[model samples]
Target: METANRIVLPAMDMNVSEGGEIEQTEIDHYVARAKGGAGLIITGACAIAFPYGAASMKEPGLSDDKYIPGLKALADAIHAVGSKLCIQSTHHGKVARIDTANDRPVLAPNPQDYSYSMKAMADCTPEELAKMGAATAGKQTTFKTMSKEDIDWLVETWADAAERVAKSGADAIEIHVAHGYILGVFLNQRDNQRTDEYGGSLENRARLACEVISAVKARVGDSLAVIVRVSGEEYGQEGALSLAESTEASQLFEKAGADAIHVTGWGRNPFDNFTDGPLPNKVGAYVESAGHIKKHVSVPVIAVGRMLPDVAEKAIKDGKTDFAAMGRQLLADPELPNKLAAGKPETVRPCINCYLCVGESFFDDTPFCAVNPSLGNEKVLPLRPTSASKHVVVIGAGPAGLESARVLTERGHRVTVVDKADRLGGTMWFSTMTTPDNERLLRWFKQEIKRLRISVKLGTRATGALMRELKADHVIVATGAVRPKPDFPGGDLPNVQTGDTLRAMMLGTATAQEAGFVLSTLGKTGRLSGLTKSPEFVRQFTKYWLPMGKDVVVIGGSLVGLELAEFLVERGRRVTLLHEKQQLGLPLAMPRRWTAVKDSEAHGVKIHRNVKVDRITEKTVEWTEGGESFSAPASMVVYADGTTSAAPFAAELEAAGIAHDVVGDAGAVNYIHGAIHSSFKVASEL
Candidate 1:
């Protein structure tokens, strides 16, 4: 039952299983991670009572022998790659949508009023809601409070599931007692309210979980390691489990035959506080709690929640936690452990904390990584080796162009990257100012460009004549999108600025004519000592010395506008955000979108939806909502809209009889996800 290393790939629901059986898609997904050098791999939530108390039909099942063959295939595949496999067993409890679909009441320890703010859902489109509703077959959830007989049935079912795991040849079984599952409900004071033996005190509340754990351990009898997952702390709710309670629960479970404690956290309310726990946005999210639990337990403690390699290495080195579970990071690049072992951390792709992957899981769909196009379709999307080497010219230095160059070079092609901008990471570099997680990705691309030693010609725009002169066998156009000026009145005013102009100003490349008085000051002062080149320096430098006035108005409330509004509000500006559409943050994933809308509102960003801009003056912005006109005082007007996909060189290349492929925003504007995925697809083929 021993693993080769301390890195653990925690369970992340692929939602690709079929009727409680593990499909090859799910098997290949885990196999990829094992091949990438992870020491331990945990399967996504497997139903102990398949299709009965299950959340989704797509989750793997261990309730019957029919599922054993699929499980065995997965175990054998992972073991052959020198990695240990652990199966996470659980009954989804009140969150089990399958029961509701079948008209059976979802089981719970107690029935109480449960509600959360729907404000976050205000930005979700109808299509997204429909997909999410399809998980439960459009049925409303109903609850059934568990009785003593039900408890006995659950305990027996858990032990039976453990037997199935042992027969499947897995090294471990993780008992689920966290994230508001059946056992977690019995452990948390907020969910369990029974006046009987299973509730009323800490020991009573922990009794059901301990009974399940002990039953599973006894059933498996040292044949499999028993890992217990618990929420070290519950957030955004009163009476939630605290560190003290969870530490004590860990000790109690240890006494109840648990082999290890895996510490995770829950936000309680998904719509309002998801980023605070579960899959947190913060780095090293649950390390402290896991450390505290480790102090009181003899078994190894596993910490999960945004455990980046550096953070995990430091935490383990300092004796904070015995293992680090990297979930989304592994999805971004399964070979992270292998790269680290090879002492090439810079070569590992980073998860940008975009929430795109988890957002798909909310709809009971397969999650895909933005950086890794081969996430779910591992076998199908492998990088193919080219038959012969050829010179390839990639036009642009952004994420798309850089990625295209990197992959082309790897496939035995000589590549030269040409960009009009002086540096790499086109708009993505500018994006780091508002989204810091993007910085890691930009840095990764930079490192790759340098490590591969691809010839880069910056500040040099590609032309038809230039392409012919370079004599490249092929060309990839990733020049990005074009941000046009607004057509509305006052859009041409001196104070009004588009995303491109603003980026130029921040980069110290904008002329005095392009930048108004307030921003022109930045170009002069920020360019000194190479300060403006660094996004971090510019982020902090602008906080105190930003030239903009207090009151600002931003036109458009899509991804860029929403994030910009939030950023401005953080910098102490009163921002008025206007959108002509009903839903804000259109292309952003639902979870991140919900959090961004909540955060923008929380930061006092005045949001006006379904509005048409009438005009903009130097001192104010006028807009009409319904039949009424509204005005907001604005000293600075930012037109964060009118961006469209454009590749002006495509026609010229076509006429010259040059073979070219258009990718990224230049082909279609889907932002970073589109840029990376499109680049990978195009480059892999060439």
Candidate 2:
């Protein structure tokens, strides 16, 4: 194994295996990780038994000895690249949706109501519940409660599966004892309530987990390493195990024969666990939990929580943990370890933690990385460079343009990036400044550009003449988009500002102070501290400009409008958002969009949907709402309708006969994901 503070790609639901057999494509996925310099990989959760233990139908299994060959093939592929492979064995107790179990009732430590409280295990007849309980005891589900004889059989069944895995030539085995699954329910006080020896006190509650570890170790012995995965904390629940309790549980498992501990955390919301907190950004956020256990146990501690190399290195340097276990980061770039080891960490694709990968898992059981298009398809797509040489010019320095330049340069292309703006990151420079979390995107752009050694020229607008002057073999246009302000009566009136112009003024790139103040007063009474920090704009408003302080109305309900309203509201402005659509920020995704709407409403931002603004006036806006003509008083009005491609140089490129591609909002007004994906795709062609 490679001896470095590198990462171990943790098990995730890839949904590639079928009926305990490894698919060739799945084999390729693991092989690519090995080739990418992953020192170790833990395969997705593999069921040890049918129905009860299976987390999903697409998951692999080791219940039958027939799966040995497929397991062997998977192991051999990783071994070929000098990497170790492990299988994660899991049993989804109550959390296993009954729908995924072929209509069979899910097994849990105890019968409880689901979150919605609409479903309960008690809803089923006593006889039916007993049948499931008996099945867990290894008997046919024809009886109530498991007989003593049945319980003995199920334990042996677990041992039998472990023995089979040992003979399958796997390097290690991880017990999935977290995430509200079977073992998790037993360990969590909120779930388990058995009066018997299997529940109650901490030690009693840990009985099931300890038993599984002992059984697996007894069957496999020192031949294969045994790891226990546990959640550090259960969020959104009361009386759940805290970090201390989780540490205690980890220690118990270590003493029960587990060779390692993989620490994770459970959250009510998906984003909470992956990106919402400092834990996700802090390398080895779980290290403290592991450190607590490490202090009491001899077993190795594995830390996982969206770990980056810098954080990983710091954790190791501080002796906080033994290994860095990364899941999403690996999905973004499996070669993370190699990149770090070579001191080329900037090349690692950053995981934005948008949860697109998690969304894919729910849709198809096959997880896909938003940033790394080759993730799930790595088995079929060649990830290595096809050619070593090409001359390329990337137009536009937006996320798409920079991403294209980065990828092309990595493929051994000579790349020159040009943009008309005075800096890289077309609209992103403004977008990032909108949210604290988004600032990382801007950091990523600058870091990647410097790492790739691609030539960059700011303030150099791309033209057909420019491409020809550079003798570019390939050109990529990522000029992005411009704010679209459709014709409205008095559209050209003073103080009628577009979102882009306001952004420019906020960033101090333009001297539109009067327009900025007018827009600011439209949203807030007078407080604009949260919207921007342009001292000059603030001073101009406090001095020469008149603060409308008048009731203001805004047109459009897109993201820009919502944010602008928020800015205005924070500044003590009375703001009302008017749109023709029924919903605001229609392009936003669910849950997040829902949350944004709630936040907007919390700020007292009025929404007049199914309305149209027909004219702008010095002190009022004329509009029709719900089929009635009306006018709303306004000191200033800002339009955040949408955007359109702004590639004035496209004609120049056509005239110069230069081959090029338009991407990002410049090609089609969209979000950042589209822009980066488009850039990467086009860059790959180059």
Candidate 3:
């Protein structure tokens, strides 16, 4: 039952199964992490009832012996690499879509009464809503209160599932009572209103979970270890399980023979409070809760929720928790553990915490990492040596260009990266001021560039002559997207700013004329110096002093615009955001996008959608929506729009007869995710 180390890969759903059977894609996904040196690997949620109580058809199942071969295959593969495998067994109670699809009422502790806000879905397109609806076959969810017989069936089902795990040769079986699953509903007072033995006091509410844990342990004996996952705290719901109740529950679980307690948190409202729990956006989210539970229970406590390497190491060293369950970090770089063990932690690619991976699970689709292109599809990841190494010139030192150079060097190709900007991370550098998590990625890329010894030419713009002089066998143009000034009336006002101009002003790359008097005044006040080059310093320094006035209006509400709006609002500016379309945060993943909109609104950012800009005056922005004229007072107007894909160098390379390809925003404007994925695709081939 013991693992090689304290690092555990907790259950992260990979909706890649086929009718309750585990496919090789899922197996390969786990195998890659195992090979990458994770001490313990836990499979995603496995339905004990299969198609009957499953959330999606892609979820692995343990209802029948027919599924044993798939589980055994995964177990054997994980064991081959000296890592222990733990199968997470669960019954997706209220969220079970299969039950709704078959016109069978999904099991719940009681009839559902609470509902979450749908305002977050206002920006979702018809296609996105349709894809989410397809998960449940477009059927309305109905629930049936679990009877006494139903509770018996559930306990038997969990025990049977654990027995199959032992038969499949897994090291442990994790009984999932967390994240609003079957046992979780009975554990929480918010969902469980029944006055029966299963749902009254704290112990009564914990009865079903302890019963199932004891049953599973008895059935499996010592052949397999038993782990129980519980929500240390539930967010966005009244009367939900708190840290105190969950800590006592952990003690009860230990008495019921749970060898380990995996502490997790749940956000009751998926749309509004996702970042507050489960996959939390904050670092070390549940470490404190897990540490509290550890003091009450004698067994090991596993803490999860953005458990990055440094956070996990400190928690373990300080005896805060027994193990750190990393889900997204391992997905970003499966080699994280190996790299850490080798004392080369800088090589570990960091998960930017963009929520792109978990967003796919909302639609019942396979999750993929933003930094790692080969997540679910791992077979395509190995850096195969090229038959002939050639000199390659990658234009622009942004994410796309840097990633291309890194991959090409791994494939034994000589690469030279050239950029017009003085810094490495083009627009991504500016993004660090708004979203600090991006700083980790920028630092990682910088370290990789230094580690790989790749040639980088900053302040050197790429051209056909430069490529010819370098004698490049291949050329990759990643100059990124173009942000032109809007063609509307008064768009050229002195107080107005475009994306390029805004970035330049923030980075201190703009001239006094381009930045106007306000920014020039700030520069003359000795604020713009060598220290301003650090995004961290500027981000903090701006909270006290910003060049812009108190009132600001941002046009366009997409990813960049929304983030900028939030940033400006947080900086004490009365911000009004206007969008031409209904979607506010397009191209950002659903969860993160929903969070951005909700947070911006909560913070008093005035958001207007489906609006047409009529003009931008010196101190006001005029727009029309639904045939109604509207105007907002603004001291500074930022036109964070008119961005289009433009790779002018591609045509130049073409005319010169030099082999080349376009990647990143130049090929299409998907931002960072598109940048990394596109660069990897093109670079791997070259």
Candidate 4:
């Protein structure tokens, strides 16, 4: 509770809790951050009540005294490490999935639309569905609109939760009224159509928030700091809480006993709120929202959403708000505060805005980072020095190989990473041409390799002879995948290339597709890339500046194809993508799939699915859709279909009788998350 810095580690659901008790994994996670020097650490939101009000059983609970001991242990762990701990309490209303509590009713101000959680509750017994709170899936199940008695019970629940939080040794209590949860549901005029005292005008609509605050304050008094999270502007729903209404709500909250106002944005769909517990929209995406609320409130304000250290520090220095809350950034690196204090931001692995953490946490309580695989396993998996260190040779420079090398070195092994390219990132580097945010990941990995003093041999394609010459104890074959040679008539024409080949040529790195066996020439590779002045690389890629003509035909409709189409369109090229599948993005999550299709369409790329390529000439491509055949003018044809293992490379290692294991694309090709996770598992074992 005492003063430190203004940095706040806001509550993020760390899907590790089980049966309403915090798991040891979750305890270890918070303790790791507390040791890393966060000023304040807020536990993931705990349920104020059971079954009906709780979001997920995997999330910790404060609904009863039985949960106190686990909360106490979590608090003591952080307190002993010199960090203040806060517990967030919530009632999820209709959003409650009730995965474990099939007997609890789904309550809301009014009947709401369907959600993933409600659908899951449908499989409950018919007897259970008849309960006041039970839900049945595959059919329309409306909410049990809260009665005045229900509202009073919720108020008492908050006060009880706050008392329990204080007894558990938490320094502060934050009421969850943001992100379309139960409390937020009551605040939204659109959701609450009640003619009762709790609904109607702005002040009337906010009566529940003020009442909850007053009740909580009356119970905890001055023993705990009270904070309320609110949506400054609910953009997602019609006639939801607006900035002006929420601004007035903030004043009323302070008057009712809130010590701080936490501002967040809302989307039309409560499940997918903008920029919080979601992929960050942009740097300081919610700063303006916080600033607006801050002007109207006397209490301290916390601004969140993809805030970098420099940006957070500046906000404090400029007095835009009192505290900066970082969720995903801290999840990426728990030592973020220490890194900033030590002025070593480059060493910090940045979040790539991938919604894996969010998607995982919501669907299953197993949130993990895309760039940092060590997350979510802080208690079990480790990088402790091996009892007997082995000399390790890694045969790729992509994410998988890089991760293997990093962990191998941490295990006190002498590590050597060899790649055929002059860069550290394998295909991930080529991906940065469209997604520049991930470019920093390459830097972080390069920095770690340098810090650990691992040997990196770029432009050195590992061969059996090379492995034998190294006399290594162990070899990790992450040689990665290669583009398939899909045969089409006249495909051998000069303008035809795979997505990888085109990307490499454009980035000033001549691909093996073009340069052939010479890619094996071992050249001095640096961590930094300077394409504009590298004479050798520039000369090799000179003819590739305009490799494709204006009109292009992409031969696949996979994720790779969609991305390639976007990149091509950004460079003023007209693209037509042909795929055998009915959908453009096959086997991707809805968020990722929708984004790919949206960006592709926004770029005006023509897409024809269920099409079979008939033939390709130097200047045109003939393809069939349904039962119809058509020919289109195309000056270039690019392969975006798929890839197969770099099989020969692994076979060479096997033939030499060497002790090597293949990870990632060399064994399996599942793109980024799969490749990184596979490498982490293999490297940890090594």
lDDT string, candidate 4, 1-686, tens digits:
46477778888888678888888899888887777778888888788886447666678888889999999999899889999988988888766767225644577887764343232222223433354233223233346888889889999988999999989888999988877688887888878787878788878888988999999999999889998998777764477788898899899999999999988776645233333333455788778878888888878899887778888888877777899988888888888888888889888878777666765543544788777777878854557668898888998888889888988888788999998877788877766665556676777888998898989998786777788788888899887788854687776766677756654564456544552323312111212345532334433343355334789888887767877787777667888888877666643433455556666877888988789898888788899888998987887788888677765776776777778888887788776777788888887777
Q: Which stretches of candidate 3 lie over 4 Å from their true place?
A: 517-529
Which 10 consecutive residues of model 4 have the lowest summed lDDT?
518-527
**CA RMSD (A), model 2:** 7.5
- Alpha carbon deviation, residue 360, candidate 3 (Å): 0.6
Q: In model 4, what is the error at residue 126, expressed in angstroms?
A: 26
Output the better candidate (1/2) by lDDT.
1
- Tens digits of per-residue lDDT for model 2, 576-623: 888877666544432234445556778888878789788888788888
Per residue, candidate 1 scores C-alpha lDDT tens digits across 114-143 of 677777777889998888888888988888
CA shift of 267, model 4, Å: 2.0
Q: Estimate each model's TM-score.
A: 0.98, 0.80, 0.98, 0.88
* Runs off by more than 4 Å, candidate 4: 99-105, 113-140, 270-278, 380-382, 488-490, 507-529, 532-547, 582-589, 630-632
Task: State, as a TM-score between 0 and 1, how close model 1 is to the true structure.
Answer: 0.98
Scored against the true structure, residue 16 in model 3 reaches a CA lDDT of 90
Error of 3 at 92 (Å): 0.6
Model 4, position 379: C-alpha lDDT score: 58
Q: Rate the local accuracy (lDDT) of all candidates.
A: 0.91, 0.69, 0.90, 0.76
Clashing pairs in 4: 15-365, 104-133, 105-133, 122-136, 122-137, 236-267, 236-268
